[model samples]
Target: MTQPNIVIPPAEQQTSVEAGDLLNSSTAGVIVERTAQVRNGFHAEGRKFARMMAEFVNVKQVGVASVFVYEETFGIKDKLHWLIHLSSLEAYEAMVHMGTSDQEYRGNVSSEQVSQDKGGGGWDKIFVDGSMQETVLMPQFWGMYGTKVDGEREKQTSVYQQQGPLTGLPGAREQVPLPVEQLVHSGNCGLLLHRTAQLEYDFRSEGRTFAREAAESINENLPGEATVFVYEEAFGAADRIHWLIHMKSLTTYYKVLALHVKDERIRDLYFQERIAPERGGGTWARMFVPGSMVDVALTPHHWGMYAT
Candidate 1:
């Protein structure tokens, strides 16, 4: 059994060692290198994809969403600026209309001045004068004018003499003997004479004459009772007279009196007696009396009176 020891061949030994080395190299090198290459390729593709996406995002932020190829087809950039400025067509139209010239705008420029040179001078004056002249030529006008001028003048002269300065004084004449009976009767009659004389003198004064004359002319042919009375009495007296005359319509009478008198006290008295009662008390009965009768009864001493 010891005579033949088995000897391993060199070719077999080489084969066995080489096979083990091939196994180790496959495990450590080939698999790892393939995996690393796959991972690197994936990362490179991911980075390129992210960069492309970022380019599109930047274009959109700059108001150019599409690239050149898409922009040529869509015209997006051209319309973007317009869309931002004008929200709607109607708003744009309205702005345009407001900026345009209009007739009202033109009129505003022309209304600042009025001129006689603009057909408002000699022609207008001629027309007015002609109208006035025609009015004066009417029969009613002449009648009214004459009565106002002449009748008023006479009446006013009478008033001035009665209450004016001339009548306030006294004068004496040569004495003559009188009967006792005549003297007794004259006592009462003298007062009446004095009043009549004073009235006559007042009617002759300038202011009274003018007022009476004007009143007569204006009131001539005026269809109703025409009378003009003058007084220098206090407001209370004037109010009493107005109340009596304007009983039918205190407001109407008050207005007429106010126009003629020009005295504030008289106006107040009229308001107190006539206007207040009719307005506050609702007294229609007292307000319906004719002014003439009231005037006659309340102011019998007045300088003038006419029945109609």
Candidate 2:
């Protein structure tokens, strides 16, 4: 119905990582990269697995770099890499359980059932990391998925963009209709440029303020191709915000970056900056992650919104 705005960034801002000939998104995931432990049935069974998780909270898909996921936080990377949609923390206490055994704290299903329904069960392995109370998601950009009863569930909110539109189905939240240009009608999950980094102390305001500013001033020449979605980690680590942009090729990603660098925009300078003492907190500095990452999940199998 409407044509989405396309954004093709400047020439010098790109990281210059050349990609091979990969037919689809399935070959190259969007955000975080994963190890062997997190792939099997991760994306396909994502929705089904959420229904069975006890500490499950909100869901958000990611697109980013190989941010060197720590060995201690292996599972978080595992989940971030393959999950069709990103899943965050909810704090075990926040969840209501049906009870398995107890004098006072039996919890929901039995340890055996928990094992069976989860990793060992016939479903996808859902990962619940960190505590919700301690998790710091940026509030300025966060909002509850629309709930007018479009057949999606209230227990969990599914936020999908740049795929198709799949949040309003039963057991999920209503789809966030960002722009028609966000989704690719049939071939594969749209190609996206993902970037991520940790934020500094009390820096939420700065992050949001800059994002809004960038929205207006970043790259006005390019429109939908630069349609970017911002997100923060819900579990494991705190304040790791991810920015996923819609640009399909590695060449195009470089083009966006190159554009900024050639013009010597503030965006490129921030890319070299890191959070806190790591580097003088520039915009990208405070968040301090580098490189332009791409989406790497199976296309049709994990559509938030798709067409036949």
Candidate 3:
């Protein structure tokens, strides 16, 4: 029996198969984000908390923790953010256990000693009560593409080999991962734009296809200037999808966004997506749930990589 010919979208043809699979193996897929609103008069204290996390707390954690501050976001002002990259869910579980068991970790972030001004647990003094929120995310597609994924293991191995023998010195026990720019020079990725939306129940696959194609088109047009990542909520709303765009700077983000209308490829894709199905157009808007979108902009804290 002969099969009939069927056309596939150009974006589908160009999409990387690896992008669709969850790379849950090692330090590449899972990201846990922590967010909190800074208290009205605690701006300097917020910075101190970030510095404390970067300098003391993050260094000892099982996963890498990089802190950020929200430059712009929906539903909150003066938000502090923490992005913890881990190997897997098992690692996350282990991290939680370690945080609970380690006395130093507890002392540094202890809610019990919130009133104290000088010692461990002063982190609570910086943020508003009941404003803390945490979300766990997995890269469903288009997640880890840069050297952060490619060279991380090799870099770690090389560092260990060079260490030879332990010598007592300042910050000797701590292992800090390389900054984003050093990992992938082309994708400096200093600023992050996080956009979240919910997909309609029936259009999950269609939404994924559209997002993959749109991301491909943007990357194709802009090249190394920007990159787009798609992540699905692992522990939150099942229908939600996250679109994370990484750019060298805010200026670079503006340039890439302008391409939606200015660039021929993106303009054509947009037009096709809006056209009717009877005219062989794309199906994009049909996949989205109304009024489920949120956008936030994050820049590195003064103590974090590529700090603003």
Kindly list the per-residue Cα lDDT of model 2 for residues 83-185, writing each as its tens digit: 2222222222222331332323342222233244444643222333331122222211323222122243333333432257532211111122334444321
TM-score of 2: 0.37
In angstroms, the error of model 3 at 12 is 34
Backbone steric clashes in candidate 2, count: 36
Backbone clash total for model 3 is: 1
Compose the digit string of candidate 3's lDDT tens values, residues 1-308: 22212221111111122212211111244667778887766666676665555444334542333222333323455777766555556666667786779887677676443345544355666678998889877655321121122234434433334566522111101111333222211113456677898987766665665665676665555554566656677778875887667655666666776888578867776556643477445557677888887778765444322232
Which is the better candidate, 1 or 3, if ranked by TM-score?
3
Candidate 2, position 38, lDDT = 32
Residue 269's lDDT within candidate 1 is 33
- Which rank order by lDDT, best down to worst? 3, 2, 1
TM-scores of all predicted structures? 0.14, 0.37, 0.67
Measured on C-alpha atoms, candidate 1 has an lDDT of 0.21
lDDT of model 1 at residue 267?
A: 38
Across 76-158, the per-residue lDDT of candidate 1 in tens digits comes to 11110000111122333433453355444334323322234543322122221222110000001111212233444334333
Which scores better on TM-score, 2 or 3?
3
TM-score-based ranking, best first? 3, 2, 1
Show where candidate 2 strays beyond 4 Å.
1-179, 182-190, 211-219, 264-308
